[model samples]
Target: MTDGTDARPVQTRRNLGIDLLRGLSILFVILNHLGLRIPLKKTALADVLPPWFLSRLNYNGYEAVFVFFVISGFLIAGNALQRWGGLERIDLRAFYARRFARIVPCLLVLVAVLAVLHLMAVPDYTISRPGQSLPGAIWAVIGLHLNWYEGRTGYLPGNWDVLWSLSIEEVFYIGFPLICLLTRRRWLLVPLLVILALSMPWTHAALRGNEIWQEKAYLPGMSAIALGVLGALLAARSRTLPARTTALLGWLGTIGLMATTIDGAVMWHLLRDGYMLLLALSALCLLLACEQRQRRGDWHAWRGLDWLRSWGRLSYEIYLTHMFVVFAMVRLFKLAGGDLRLGFLWYLLALPLCWLLGAAVERWLSTPCERWLRAALLRAPAAADPRQPASVAAD
Candidate 1:
């Protein structure tokens, strides 16, 4: 996407592989939450299923989110770099507008819905703290400090807890563009980002005993995004490599990503902090491979992943709203005598329902509001510049 900028690079179509990764990420999050509600130790499926299979299904949600951070960093940083050529020419107002449009509309809807649900006494929606009110929860989330608040006070109920990631991401973004803008040389960003990338594991090692470090620490997430930035930089320069070499790196990355999810390994225990860093690097490799394929005009070769493209397109909405599906399913399970075995079946039903809900939110609210807001913002006298073009789509 461009903002009528002369520096804008030639826009490419969305890569199916990125879409598929995003789709899988959201699906993993939903399934992970669903598995949490189900008492796996008491279920027949748990008994019959291989341990490896259960571990993969139940515990990989965080990994999927790691995928999202890298992907988001790659895309967002790539977009900014393309638009301004360097951060010096960047339009901070337009950049903020783009993000606000993409994120705020759906978030407002989510907050409103949850507030209503909390007031109605929906299970798992009630305020957890003695003195806290619904507006207290709402303001904390709106301020994007909910992660810190939760780390101190306790968790918000159910899906509201998902806002923690959003809080961390937005906080990171607050400094990302500024850092890029302030650096006098493009190469300087490497050292800056590298330090940020390493900060997570360092923090983890130093603060292993701290609950906030264990729970809502923001540096790890920033590290993942920074790694994506590094990946994007490498991808931009890798167009000269033979396709075969790039493809091999891509496959290796894919394998490494899958290997990180395995539960029974000594490697998992020994490399706990570095494990996520590896996942981010693998994601970067996959992204670089996709960039190579895009350059080769074969990025869309995988038609089987088209379904995932739809999921990826709506990933933001799905991520925010899927908890509603989770809460409802949990309530239904309770009404049905709380049978843990039935959770698998309920999870199946939730998948489509969450997709449908996300689709509707995108079609009716988020997409339109984003388009209108961007258009309006660009049209405003203060926002307009004849020297620059209109804003273009990012992905």
Candidate 2:
């Protein structure tokens, strides 16, 4: 289907399995928010679904985000290698131009809407905390440290709070190219990535009890990206796995992913801070398997997952704008006297609306703005180096 895992610039062709993983991860984010805003009770969903399956379906947002971190790292790094020939050969200005074009348009639109909403004194949209202000939040976002601000002052409104992950992603990319540049000079990039990623467990452990820091901190999040980079480097150099080996990895990934979701409470108790690291690693394995299988063009196209495929394709837009639909649905549910009986129905409505909003934003805003900015900003294409080989498509 050539469905890419991220809203990125370099796309020769994409793997279907990667799209499915992205789709699943974003779904987790939505379900997590839905459960957070209006707590899903046993009385609501347990009547039809089994307790184990229902448990898996609830509050999977954070783990799903880790999956994204890995996928994003894998795609961006793999694409860079395909485009520029090597990480060290990366062009800093061109890399930044492409990133700025793709990311900033939607980001600015989101924050502008948020600023207007907060100014209007909407219920859930307000920066109600005594310590938080509109200007401060905006500055934090600009500085790529929104996560730090939230850790110190407490959570912002739902719409703004989602930017925590973006903060982590921004900072990681800021360093990603720089690290690649350093590899050209003298330092070994592979070992450097390894050392940084190995430090992830300690980063997670250091702030184990701090809820905001654990989820939003830079080191822990960047580590996942590093692991993903390593995965890409490995895939670029390694031979494809045989069918049996691919099957084994596929089973391992599916079981581990499901266990983390379905028996989340159990995994939480067993792994604690290690839970996130485990999730990221499992994602790494699954993506590698998908990459190998995809190269052979041997994957089955499941018609039932087309909706999720759409979600994955528009994941970047959906991730930013879905919360607006969520809050609106919450408000409507409140007008309905906040009945739990209707909570499930709100989810059904919210998902399609999120898809619609995401589609509209992509068609009207993100894509057009990206094209305009790229034309204005770039003197040369980001992918072609002329000195390097042509960009190759990958999972």
Candidate 3:
């Protein structure tokens, strides 16, 4: 189950439930993008479905990114805790190297591809107002501030704009290790995470009028990440809950996730712009259920959902590359004289292509590069950590 070269576990280390959520989240992202390109109209299905329900189904892409953020925090914290025994004791160099190895290559390739598209004047890949950007979109991508750049300079193309989430995520990953070391004591780490979680409302509130910042601000995203970290710590320390208890937690979490993720979710005064805490806590509930299953060694694949699990495992690849598929497919749909009535067919064709592209990238490029970089950058631990049996839901 271990990859001997890098000392990381192989696919068997993958947790099924976690992958399922990841898969679902990425799919939501794609669905949202598709809906935007060719919006759902008064179809037979839409007519039959409740208006709110249809609306929720259409615009969940933004919420799905928050789901991914929570997952990222959980995986990173859980992995570090398992490997190093404590966050304070983490090997900073090894952590940085592994993260860099996994993240940088794909990023560079994405930027390079964007450059080519910009040169060719591809409609959805070209930067907007390059003059105002001073250096260019590449600078924002490299600086891990794409979200901020967009906030200041208006939007980039669809493919590049998607990197905004990456900026938010990478910023956390970059700072996480240092924060862990700084707050070595468990008491301090616990409260710091708590404070961040509690600050979610204010964080979002602070960005009140600014539409972009209201949605993609750093503090708001970090609040969710903080909740995820807390969830990991909680799951790692607690004993497996009883079957009924786990089920209850799972149901509660699932409902919360759906509430937040579904477009036009019930609005509260304090959470007008975002629902960071609710989404994170909901995700945490599911994580707790998944963690319990992991501990009980019953984390087997749910039959008929293997495709979703694969998507979950490939979430990172799919997330980064899917916009390319979306843009191309939409263009083709338009060229083929497609209309909103044919949107479903477009999705049917385009989704598989997205999966195919993501899978190919993983198999041919990212996976190999990740392995090589980890082997080169991360030193095998002094004592091999026991093949970590569970609780790694993955990033």
Candidate 4:
């Protein structure tokens, strides 16, 4: 739905497949974080728990974030192409306004809260280094430099550490629109993005020894996003494939994705090096299936995945605030003499709490502020200018 302020014609019809994938990604991210923060090994049930399941949980967060990056590239690039009719006619101002509206509101609120908690000397929010002040942390986050900061120094606390992904994403986006506008030849853009996407694996291979570099490099994340752009471009051009073929691709992609995500032992250097790219390819395959379904008007097929769609709608908020829930639950467990059983209970409760907080932020704050600010920033198109079409101008 158009939020009236950004002047861009927003796609109102929700894609159930995209939502389902996004929802699944966010769930994977939460589970990964839980595995890290909670001492589940200390619990009585640890011995009985399947080792495979535990390994799967810990290994998938990076892949999930990879999915998210790809999806962002697909959706953002697709929208800009659709609105402007082509990259040659893209309106950078409108793009920035929409991005600002969608991203800034919730992000600023989260940063403010984190800063306050750090200032209050909360253990969970405490600075990781002696010289690094709260203001510096806040500045890095706002400036989208958290990834660089963490790579140079160590990590920030739980909530702040998550900003590394956000920083990488925003920085990539800062260049996305300009790059699109600069390239007059549309075909060249796809090939260029593909080249970058392919280069990502080599980049990762080059950084093999550095833990921080491997964990939070912009190149790796950007590579995923580039693959996403390639996916969108191909999907836009291709006709719907046979349902059986699409289904096979989807299943193969999903299985490969799951297998690769958990295989951190590096049984083979080639497979390990290519896994990130494979994960993006898997996501792309699924996205292609989703696109085909949309092309065929198969909305009824989404009946079972409604919860995924709901989670997808609130995915951003859940991602930003879930760390708070994790930190709180961890602190409470410590206060109560560190009962490991509480980890299970907290995990159960935290899921719903995250949904509630995210929904509240989206409804009461982010949505309204975006609507108002976008409206203020973007002006309606002038009817006299045929060259500057209504679709290209904001509101």
How well is each residue in 6-38 modelled by candidate 4, as lDDT tens digits? 345544455677778888888888878877877
3 or 4: which has the higher TM-score?
3
Q: Could you tell me how far off, in angstroms, the CA of residue 182 lies in candidate 2 after the best superposition?
A: 1.0
lDDT of 2 by residue, 308-350 (tens): 9778877888999999999899899889988776578888899
lDDT of each: 0.74, 0.78, 0.76, 0.74
**Residue 2 lDDT in model 4?**
45
User: For residues 1-395, what per-residue lDDT tens digits would candidate 3 score against the true structure?
Assistant: 33233344333356778889988999988888888877655334556667566556668888788888888788778877776777887777777776776778887898888888888877877665744342568898899998888887777788888889888878987888898899899898899999987788888888888788678889888888888899889987998789899889999998888777663346445466456677778888998798788778876575899998778877777888999989988889889887666566787888889999989987777767766776666544322322132322232
lDDT score, candidate 2, position 83: 60
Residue 100 error, candidate 3, Å: 0.7
Going through the candidates in order, what is the number of backbone clashes in each?
Answer: 6, 0, 1, 5
Q: How many backbone clashes does candidate 2 have?
A: 0
Candidate 2 positional error at 306, Å: 1.3
The residue-level lDDT of candidate 1 at 283 comes to: 82
Cα deviation in Å at residue 4, candidate 2? 20
At residue 364, candidate 1 shows an lDDT of: 86
Q: What TM-score, over all chains together, does every model reach?
A: 0.91, 0.91, 0.91, 0.89
Q: Candidate 1 on 147-198: residue-level lDDT in tens?
A: 7777767777877888888887888877777877788567887998888887
* Ten-residue region with minimum lDDT total, candidate 3: 382-391
Of 3 and 4, the candidate ahead on lDDT is: 3
Of models 2 and 4, which has the larger lDDT? Answer: 2
Model 2 root-mean-square deviation: 4.5
Worst 10-residue lDDT window for candidate 1 reads: 385-394
- TM-score quality measure for candidate 3: 0.91
